[model samples]
Target chain A: MPFQPGCRRLMLQIDILLSALANGLMTGAVYALIALGLTLVYGVLHVINFAHGATLTAAMFAVWAAHDGLGIDPYVAILILTPLFFALGYALQRFVIGPASHGSDSNILLVTLGLSIVIENALLAAFRSDTRSIDVPYGFSVIELGNLFLPLPKVIAFFASFLVAALLWGLMAHTDIGKAIRAVSREKTGAALSGIPVEHVYAVTFGLGAACLAVAACLLMPTFLVNPRVGNAFVLVAFTIVVLGGMGSVPGALIGGLIIGVVESLSGLYFGESLGQIGIFLIFILVLLVRPAGLFGARA
Target chain B: MTGSARLPILIAVIVLALLPLGATSNTLLNFMTFALIVALAAQGWNLLGGYGGQFSFGHAAFFGTGAYAMGLLQVRFGLNPWAAMPVAMLLGAAVGWAIGFLAFRARLRGAYFALVTLAFAEVFRILANAWAFTGAAAGLLVPLKLQAANMQFEDKRLFYWLVLAFVAGALVLTAELARSRFGARLVALRENEDAARALGVDTLRVKLAAITLSAGVTAAAGGLYAQKSLYLDAAIAYGPWISVDALLAPIVGGLGTVFGPLIGALALLGLGELSKMALGNLFGGAVPGIDLIVFGILLILAVAFAPRGLLGLFDRLIRRPRPAEGGEATP
Candidate 1:
């Protein structure tokens, strides 16, 4: 009550900025989760996985089906869907992508592109391309701090991203499968010579990547809607994050995700929503041209 | 048939040219015109992606650039379509050169190159959608002028014939390029960039030239599209679908062949029709997804079973597999 009116106005602007930043970080956390899958697939496969967005969309639909068709809670659906998608991802790589590509980099690119087309249309055909969202009890509930309101599900997603990242880090750093995956990523021929089951490791990595999508979809479905093409909105941003973080660096993705989220949020605040997309793409081009190795990636 | 690219292209062109005499349906004419437009765009892709070995996933940048030019010049400046088409093509080539300069200078290749091009296309799309001069989201429409001078014909078959002429010229140019010294240099870089550089080829220059030419041809296709459709929108001009269609025809028909995009475009459209007929019922009739689903499957199958495409398959069926050491490695 005793505050100067001008100072109060400045304080309110700061609060709005802070709120946008918080919202961005939340969206970015999910983006990181999405990018983690992309980066992991790239590490071993050595090709950009075009099917990633469709896979996320597929997983989101799976989550939606669990909620609407089977009457399972979205959060609980995550536990069931993650492993199921891991298997789907594994089989897709082993049976479809790997065999079809025959180890050519260009061929793999086409195959993945084709996979995206198939997966997106399959979802379209199955779901009829309508956008749907779950009606969670707390969907409109928010945590209020001063004038700022943070949605409950988004806050949960922000924290869940860290937990997922930590778990993924532990797996990559400590587990034998992780080691094999890394070894294969570093050098397929060398890994093969060193008694690693190269093909199996590739499949496992793909499975892990898909598992990440399932987790992300489950987390996102609460705050985000599902449609045949919903993942596309996130995919470009994820690609930007993956590139910014270094192509294969998990930590880079996490940090990059947050940075991009903030940038996107601030830009959207200033430039309006649609035109704000230019900011992310400009950042992407700058990073790619100026420091393509990204902040964390090993120099190619 | 065996040695001359000209012979096959000529025969194909003659057959296409004669189609108007036998078929009088407007739907067929419209369909043929659209297929030719796609084939032109695919030929553009074939130059850089197939022959030069640079796979650009965002060719829409060039296509949309050209389309926008054609749209703005004709609609805003009231220029003739013939004049606008070349200007649109030059603009597209300029965009290609600028992108190539930055991307190649940075030594980006493979997936990096693909993604960057995609980003550029999206950027152009965003700008186009926002700018009032480009008609913004309401889209730019070419006035319905039915005069031959406007490049729009009262008779739909005339438009079909005109497009066939353009496609025929593109095919001949592509065939000529395939046998040229510059073409050999492109193939050299494609096969082994480091080795080509080591052998004194200016790899950067070759890539830039290929991309510029590629974009120009693709832009011409875009110009042709604008004239035919008589309307342009952000989605139709700069969307990823054109980029995909541009590349798909070449990859499916034959990657490095002069005739690939034309053949691929026809076959692909044919396949779409076949799938619509066969699988439309499987998914409940009239769903749009069935044709694309078939396309995706066909793309995978093409890469797996016939990497060189239909022409290559024909080559294999007619002749013995070349003994590795002494045979020419030409596509």
Candidate 2:
């Protein structure tokens, strides 16, 4: 049973790679979901929506508190929270965010950044800086498929990402409201002149975007340890994904999301832990160079 | 010069210059130095973000690169501080030139450009954490003694004067830039890119110039910051806090105006110190992430109510007449 040094080294390398990939995918799926909302808002509004990450974290906290404090299941909490988040999103867009949108892109960006700060800090103040995690009854369960093992929570998160992305795609491609959104995205005054309720579309866009976070939050609860600062990790990756997927391109978000997930996964595995984020950012820069419009982005 | 127009500027400069003399403690003086460096950073940021209209969310890259350039030269190569700073600026300018070339070439304007820059900063941070020469996660610490030319001074007042001098230099430089042909081109590009391009303005060249200069100024601040803090690390250099500080100053004061970043820095830094003082009392333990919240809220309010910034608000309160009203209108 004596093993050669080279063989042993190769075995260790494989193990590290697998672990890094596993972590990257698990985290990247959640990142994709967050970016999907951001991408959606951008697709319609051409605004960065810095609040996207904060909203996701806030919702994750909401789900965590509901499940932990109130003894409600995270899955069930989503149904209760989706509507509430939508309304909040609607009000935020209609009253405060939309008015700021009238100026340059910088104006919109600053407003969202501000909103994110408010949400994040308020969460920090209320929840304190301690990390929060919900213990799903079956959170740790994993299925063994040959050489790889997939955790139950990650699978759930992946599936949630798929479902939400699919639904968003459907809404944009197959629905009347989606058409209005697309119309508005093309030309605002033109869309308005054609009797499209521009304001309603903007509200709905933000609401749906926030609603995506609601689903992401629920899926995220059992897996990632929720913290006031969790949004910081997600923001950069989400931004990269949105850019890669094309600013407002919907299907691009899905494709961009998956590509990032895989890259994140593989990079972590091949490289050390520290190189994981740097690896993703390199991909982001490369993609920007190779395809300015994103992988599947429509030509500007 | 009109007394009304020049009065506020004069008063503000006088107040800032006298700040260190009145301060008794090193802590407060240190804070003022920190604020001044950040204000310098904001001014640098203003060149790209405010005037050029290329909002960058990730300026920490330049800051970190400058610090590291100097740090690496000093520790690894044993170069003098005076020799290292200019070298750092040159290196910083090169990196800025590269990033700007790539991003601008891709037509990554506005939010996308901002994101790319931010991502670049994150990359630098991760690299800083991984790289061996900079001590990886432990960070690179440059030794400091009472060497004036080394940019290290035992006296807080001396350090304060150095930072104040840098601030004045930045202000004069920015003022000069704002009046230059390149500055006019920047404004034209900002106001109407298509029109500027049509007018045969080399838009990309103008942006590159602004960005390179911005990076140089920011790098100088980073060098001074490394000396003053006596600790240069990836987190301190490339942290989101640095970016936020850079962003907030210009917004609070005014984005494009010459004195905006300074005014913004003074206001935001004062409020931030005050808030910490007030909140530190209410909460016994370390109150983490509260400043971030305040920064975010301030950004929102600035964008929503006064996109033009505090300078704009001040102008409004004083009811200053426009050049049109002063018989400068044509046609």
Candidate 3:
């Protein structure tokens, strides 16, 4: 039997909207995870880690290496890789970032930018610019709910993002080390005076930030392809998210990411892919113009 | 400004001007032409990023706009390249002013301002990629017209001379600006905007003017680049790589210095070519990213060791003797 044409069109429109919303939420979760790491480091160190995306790319490469070479699952690789990355981040802060901290803001910015270029180009040299992806058992699996379908990998990534966020919240709220980090972020001199080991906290906070990237990379491996320039593709979006979410605010990152994800997905559906980016940038410019402090940022 | 300071620059310019006379290699001339064009763009960037202290991460917008303006006019409208060049530069300045005005009015500073510029560039890139008039991802190609008025030449030597003239003009302009009251105001703003404001500096107007001038000059370079390459694509014109190149040269040499961009362009491009050669020799094949790795390492070292750049080191060396001379006079 032929259905009513108008009714069928309406149903299809609803389905499209629902799908876009669902995808937006999932993508937003990943964006939030990435931005959270950036915000954490920014909040504590007062330095924008321009290499945040590069670190994410490095972590993704690490996951791929373990999975491809050792036949380890990506999830399992996360457990091993996260700690290693944390140590690497710790060392980076202690050595490279520590010295530059005394310089001007531009100095720090340029140093991080240079580091990003180094990591990205090093990866390009090593990997030869080929796009790689992991194939988990559930990579293509999907869940059906009424008129909606959800990709399993995205679902897993979404939940993983939340799980990590929750863990970070718990760590920050309850742990002694977390308190020290908070103290340092609030006032380095005061934290030092109070015997909180401010320098140590800075290193550890940066390490934690890198560890978050490791988790994000592990979660993203099943859904996104990895390449030397993949970080470049996402870095701008992460910056947008951080700015939208009030720079260093943890909850703000989550909210900002979701908003950007929805805007991107909806615009993509309506206009096309490239214009979707324009849409996000439009929003970014608007945010900068209207409220440079961001929605959740503390008033200066 | 001083005779001592001007002497080396004069000597360098003379050497560069006479280089093509002895050299017969089209390859070398072409390389120098590209470097000089980049130097021109970098000089423009230096006006804003170094002197005005507004580090733009999205100069590609102005560049791409200029390239596209020239390409579209020449291809679609059948306009003369000479006519298109100024219009394109004006368009670039307009866009720069718009972005600068919005950012400055909002009082965005440092990283926030940088990111806003990046956003504008990305917006342009996306538009160029998606718009049919821009030929989408296929890009627009300039017709192969070997005419001076068209800004195209049969010989690379002509292009080299053309680009060298522009680079020299930029250098002279920058030098003049450096010694001017406007330049002093810009430097004051860079040192401390609040303090500059307290001293009655029209911070916003100075910044806008600097950025507009910077964008206009960069756009002119972009127009020449399009004519030379005969192609206008989003990636080539508006890519982040272009912005990086523009800023990198000034940073590597010495931000806010008149001769910095020229020295930086020579250093960066020369190093890039040398590294490519070295890597090709070692690997026995073309490795695509070795130059970038070299550049990255160099930039890191530059930032870490010489935050003020190579010219800073030279300044110290030059002034060392002056202090010694003063001590001798005192004794």
Candidate 4:
């Protein structure tokens, strides 16, 4: 039975509960997008991409530049920035990280770490550590569901995540390049022997990952503010999601992100915001300690 | 340990000791003081990463623990700073042992171990930032009492000599480890854990011991930092910046060697000051991050071009190849 909003105080808890879940879902969608990119790269490269946060920061800056300088809407800027970021990611992996690493795991790790340091410091130098956001017309708009109101930008991001994930799934399932990517990630030597230009496939995978980050950055700019350090917070959460989702599993990432999001939202409701961040790390540590394979364990 | 092999370390320490007598510029003293502190921290890292081949990504966990212990014991409980320093190292060992036990028991190695350690450091940072016992976000500051007993000195050179003493001690310890039976087992495990285990090495015990000692050594550096700076914050103590520094020094100097951290710290931080000066001149003011950008480039270049670090490069330049001794300083 539906209770009247103005009539009863008992319904307030229920309202808060529902609201937290709704916010969790909305936030989870963005996390899913971020983790998807990380998972894809981890799947193919077999090395953690230490520069993932810096790359996201760069994409956020691009969106901010397009809006603040050129007057393009954040959503409209996504179309231009996604492909641009794709090319940038492709070039970075194809030229810098590839040759520098020389196919060694430890070398790759160091090179990526170095790359992150460079990118982050460069952003700090250029941006002066200022928080940036797009002042959209619809930034304040909200949709009312019963007694709960959800912000419209979050609502848009939630659905956009579904669309992107579906499109990515279709691409992986049906496209020739996608087949090559899967083959390469599964067996590099075999894929190369089977005439799949392995290096090209690696570059393509990196590009797609960066494209995902661009879409995520665009969706985020309307509601969230950007600074050089902001992406670092998300990077840790995204890593937790990847771990929970079983490293390289796409569906696992989406579901794991939603679970973590709900957990984070509820913990924030209970604990103070700063301390609540610890909940994510606790869950991550527990997952690593208790079940290294993860609950999903689909493709671990 | 052979006296001839330890000849270089002796000369280096003596040179460092005499440096203040010859040229006591405050800038140079400040740089050397900070560099030696980093070298101590890097020595802690090299014990596990370079010797045991663990490659941790969250050494800040140990460093911060040490710093916080020094702060809380002094500020809250009114413990003497001298006593608090050792306590910090003890706590660091306990923390390291706990993490090592859980991780090694689970058989997590390589990247997984690194990730877990990183997560642990984040947990500590968040707790320290928010918890009241550690003074919350305002951070803890040591009492500004100028006395040798309190480990504070007005002259600054006394503190420099004190840090060099600690660094010298760490160098001797590392040099001793190169010839010790424990170091042999550690290097054996690094080469191949399965082979070492088959050859009767207690792999788990050795790793745990290495991590515990590593944490203690690193914590000592943290304690010294708190004493020298007279302040400690969650970010300052527990940040990823320190963790990177702890790793970078040994790699740039010469991995698994006694003097790697000291040489690496001086070279790296020296380059850092050079960049800062250049950028300051160019921009006409203090500008952040130009040096770090240079550091990042150097890290990549070092990995790609000189895997054995500056010491190895020097060795090549001099064309002096030492005999293959036990526990050669190479991965």
Number of backbone collisions per candidate, in order? 0, 2, 0, 0
Model 4 C-alpha lDDT per residue in residues B241-294, reported as the tens digit of each score? 889899888988888888777888889999989998988899898677888888
Better of 3 and 4 by lDDT: 4
lDDT against the true structure, per candidate, is: 0.90, 0.81, 0.86, 0.88
Best by TM-score: 1
Ranking by lDDT: 1, 4, 3, 2
What is model 2's DockQ versus the real complex? 0.56
Superposition TM-score, candidate 1 onto the true structure: 0.97
lDDT of candidate 4 over A1-300, digit per residue (tens): 465655566678889989999999899999999999988988888877878888999999989999999999989988999999899889988988887877877677888888888889888888878888889999999999989899999999999988999999999889999999999999999999999998889888889989999999999999999988787898889989988887878988899889988899999998869867999999888888877767676523
Residue-level lDDT of model 2, residues B1-331, one tens digit each, is: 1113345555666787788777788788878888899998898899888888888888888888888988889889989888998898888878888889988888888777877888888888888887898878898888866778777776778878877878878887787777778988998999889999999999989999889999888887888788777677789988877777888899878988888899898788888777777787898765766666667777877877776789888887799656553211321
Q: Write the per-residue lDDT of candidate 3 for residues B104-177, one digit (tens) a residue.
A: 99998888888888888988888898789988899988889797767888777878887787877787788878
Q: For each candidate, what TM-score against the reference?
A: 0.97, 0.91, 0.95, 0.95
C-alpha positional error of residue B192 in candidate 3 after TM-score superposition, expressed in Å: 0.3
lDDT of 3 by residue, A205-299 (tens): 88998998999898889888999889876778888888888888999999998888888899999988877878877888998888866789986
Instruction: Name the docking class for model 1.
Output: medium
| Prediction 2 TM-score vs. true | 0.91
Clashing pairs in 2: A43-A248, A114-B296
**Candidate 3 docking category?**
medium
lDDT of 4: 0.88
* Fnat score for model 1: 0.69
The reply for model 1, stretches above 4 Å from the true place, is A1-3, B1-3, B281-284, B320-331
Give the RMSD in angstroms, all C-alphas superposed, for model 4. 2.8
